[model samples]
Target chain A: MTTPTTGLPPEPAGRRSWLRDHSELGVCVMLLVLGALVLTDALTMDVDLTQRGPVGPRTVPVVVGAGLLVVAVLLAVDVVRGGRGRAETGEDVDLSEPADWRTVLLLTGVFLGSAVLIEPLGFPVSGALLFWGAAFALGSRRFDRDPLIAATVSLVAHTVFDNLLGVPLPGGPLMGVL
Target chain B: MNALTSLLDGFGTALTPINLLWAAIGVLLGTAIGVLPGIGPAMAVALLLPVTYGLEPIGAFIMFAGIYYGAMFGGSTTSILLNTPGESAAVVAAMEGNPMAKSGRGAQALAAAAIGHFAGGMVGTVLLVALAPAVAGLAVDIGAPDYFAIMVLAFIAVTSVLGSSRIRGLASLLIGLTIGLVGLDRMTGQQRLTFGSLQLADGIDVVIVAVGLFAIGEALWVAAHLRRGPPEPIPVGLPWLSRGDVRRTWKSWARGPFIGFPFGAIPAGGAEIPTFLSYVTEKRLSRHQEEWGKGAIEGVAGPESAASASAAGTLVTMLTLGLPTTAVAAVMLAAFQQYGIQPGPLLFEREPDLVWGLIASLFVGMVLLLALNLPLAPVWAKLLRIPRPYLYAGILFFASIGAYAVGGEVIDLVILLIIGLIGFGMRRYGLPVLPAIVAVILGPAAEQQLRRALQISDGSVSGLVGTPFSVTVYAVIVLLLAWPLLKKAVTRRRAEH
Candidate 1:
């Protein structure tokens, strides 16, 4: 489960075992960075003296940033001392198993693909691709039947939104026809 | 001006032919989505917000009321038949409901759950109508200092009560506040965290955060450990139970509203704690001890009712004070905001017809839910067998559509993807997502009220505790945060003996 999911280079052997165990320190680092960024932005903010009051807009951010720094330090200490969150078992989920990365990557690509093409291809076409790609990612092996169903679903969704619901979803090349 | 008179007038609007039609459509759509795994009412409302954008505020909200109850109604079906409760509130139901289904008593379990929802929803609505106006009347006197005090209490209690740990909960809240701070400052019109991005200056929409967290985030997590093979859905028959089953359920159903209402009425309103408490209560008071683990009808009736009743209790705070204690309420708040409306105490005096109509519709929606869902239980159960991949993929498709349709900008989709990833990471690390959502919706409001109180006091910090109400609220907040830890320490020490 601790497998590097972001397609990063594998960790060096032996020296970083402790870091692997306390991988949540990565969250600590992110929080600290965020806090520092907020603090720097707030401190460097130029306030007009004429407009300034008792509590400027920077006050809450400064307090929040400081609070975040304290929390990040506390969380890091806790993680280094072997504190860890228990896996959620309340649902039917089995969290101990490694993720099916192939499927996840495929689904991610499908969403990003639809996002990139939504303007150029329109709802009917891009939506069909999204639905088909998602179906393929989810292990539907019937290439012949799945895309047809995906198109039907996409067209129906498009008609419902664009025509019936009056949301004016773009139709791309089919803009005039739709 | 009386509550009863206002409610009767509200019925005048809700019972109209067109409004009735909208209510019907809302429930049908709501139940369909709720029957799907991991899609709760909040996600349903956000995804469907665009569909109802053209309707009048009353009609839209009437539909929203229907959808709200319908989600609770459908969530129980998934729990009883699939053993995969879609909402956290229904997790308790899955315990006995799944066992009942395995024993070929699936129909009885579904009936108990549906009927229990009906009973609880009606009782909860009655309580809401009776209690809300009075509370709003009292809340009219609550100044900004008291309001700020209560918001602080809500922040502390919600984070501590719901999450796996207080540390993670606070982190989630701070992150929400940070995300909320991205837009222009409310008082001074200055950018705090936009990072010089023109698109982000308008702020990330609450609907995006909601759908991204509950719908998209859950999708990603489920995608990682994608369950292989088809889930065997329990085949449900006609919805009915034996006389003995009915007899056994009555007492638990009666006890449900009693145990559920007070816990839900409190400031930290949610279905989770009360539903669990009612489950424990029913367990302790059950006649058949052997049936506790196997399949108890009481188990289904009590928790489902508690969940629905808690939902009703949440409305007390949501409607009367404009405080949203749960994620669903927060999105509903956004809905109210979308129509250029706010739901503070003035809402009652200014929009009596709308408020009472919505309340009246809650009663109407409850009856409609039982009548509509009871017969359709078997059909709804078949939806559980939808291919996991396609079903979840369908959810993502709808999520993107909902996000993009909100503003007709591709930038919203980008925000959706970013927030969805953050949501996935939050869940992966065992942080509760609800607080972040609650904080996002409430943080700006909290800040506004805090600044108002201070401005009124001319920078005197002591003005925050100027009133008895504010002082009492702060004291309760301290107790609420400390009592659980104190109890745990005492219990641990005693156990060492």
Candidate 2:
């Protein structure tokens, strides 16, 4: 990705440089779009006018939508005015770094997979898989100990949450046996 | 005498085997979550909210209270050992604690923190028992205008105090206030920002927003910035505090609760501000100037105590006013509402047993926390050894499961992902997330009160300032807003000299 320079000078100490860039501009545009979407829905909302004394249903939305517009403008103004707040203190992580990308993708995969598999595999088995997979993603290659630890954690959590705390997590295929 | 006797009765209810067990569970969970990096007590309580659904109301309250203080203790442990604070309140602890660890005095720092925590927790609990009813009595007399004024003050205070920059904080808060307006209007049944999504018609769950922002967002942020370096091995030594160390810390422990409790009782009052204030105070008052940043024992003692004390203090307002001073308190308040037991002025008159039993259990929970944290500091430290990948993966899995378990709605999972992305972006952009979370929780309540005040006065703006109490509250808000500018001016003049 090309770094689109907005010609704004870099931030001073203790401030983030990204805020000086065009990122927030994109966010503001998104907010405006969201506001339009919300306002459209709010206009079509069925409001009862008979029971209320003063304030009605559309009052808060209209107010909120208008407020969002005002803030979006202010944020735009701040960006243009080069209003720098605090400088970023820590070393910036390289977004393009392959190692970093691997970790990100691995974690995302684990989350997505767990969401899909949790009901079928049960929390105990799926949770263990999730935990072990994540550990592997984060560079823990202790293959011998990882599975045992993951299973232990999953079983303990299942026992506490399902048995003691009474959360009705699916016991999966092992429901009757367990 | 009557008050004393009533407290004894309260204690009687609290010490019951069932209540005691719940309290123990709450503290244990609180401390465990607190110890974990990136998870605070708020997320802990929110995550556990589903589990508490079937619990007896009293047991639920007991467990919630335990988790509250337990997180405070656990947070300090991470600050001391890893320099990764679980919450903002522990940031000050990290200053001295990390230094202490580097110097091989980690045990002493941990010991001091535990003791300070115990002292602060006890003092705050005592205040809660003695002062809550009186506060509740006073609160009953307050009208919408006064409530509105107080919330305004809270909004300003929290935004200005919690973040590195006020503009970003306010922006975050505004975003929250906007989110708060999404559900059906209390006065008019009209949906404000639902956008034809039926699941959103009921409004976004505070739990979903909270869990998404704090838990899921944090997990993502950590994954992106995952450190590849080997863990710093903490040196082992005697875990006992020296007599001199104890003597030095005692004064700070005693003073910390006084500083922390009042802040905790106020709206927007959470552990962050008081703990920061406590750390600055200890630094300013210390005779050992060289020890200020070089593993000063006082640094660990004061902030830890203040954080724990504030936890206790927050419970007082939560129980009495039906106002949540922090995210964890809000979840607990929601839990109480689930049980159909409103925690406000009438609570004492209506459910004295539940109120007092909960209060007494705080004392017991504090003792248990101290016992567990003091000797088992190393055990808690070992939790940090879990690989970042596995840890975050587990968190993400649990967060999704917790979201699904809440309503069994796929929509909630979608909201979680959206909010998680938003949270990740917020962190990436350097915006503070706490104020946003706080605003989301309080925004609806604040707006409703404002609208009601306006209605009462026939849409007159002056209606908000009608009563003497309301006037006083607004006056305080004005002063609070102005005080920052005044302080800045005074400091500039001094610098010029």
Task: Kindly report which residue stretches of model 2 are placed more than 4 angstroms away from their true locations once superposed.
Answer: A1-20, A46-51, A83-102, A117-159, A174-178, B267-269, B484-497
Considering summed lDDT, which 10 consecutive residues are worst modelled in model 1 chain B? Answer: B260-269
State the fraction of real interface contacts model 2 keeps.
Answer: 0.31
Local accuracy of candidate 1 as per-residue lDDT tens digits, B118-211: 8888888889988998899988999989989988888887788776577777877888877777788888888878888888888888778877
lDDT of 2 by residue, B153-272 (tens): 667767776555565666677777777777777776776677667888888877778778877776776677765652454654546788998888888998899889988987645888
- CA lDDT, candidate 1, residue A47: 67
Cα error of candidate 1 at position B459, Å: 0.8
Q: For each candidate, what is the lDDT? A: 0.81, 0.74
After superposition, the stretches of candidate 1 with alpha carbons farther than 4 Å from their true spots are A1-17, A50-52, A87-92, B267-269, B492-497
Candidate 1 has an fnat equal to 0.40
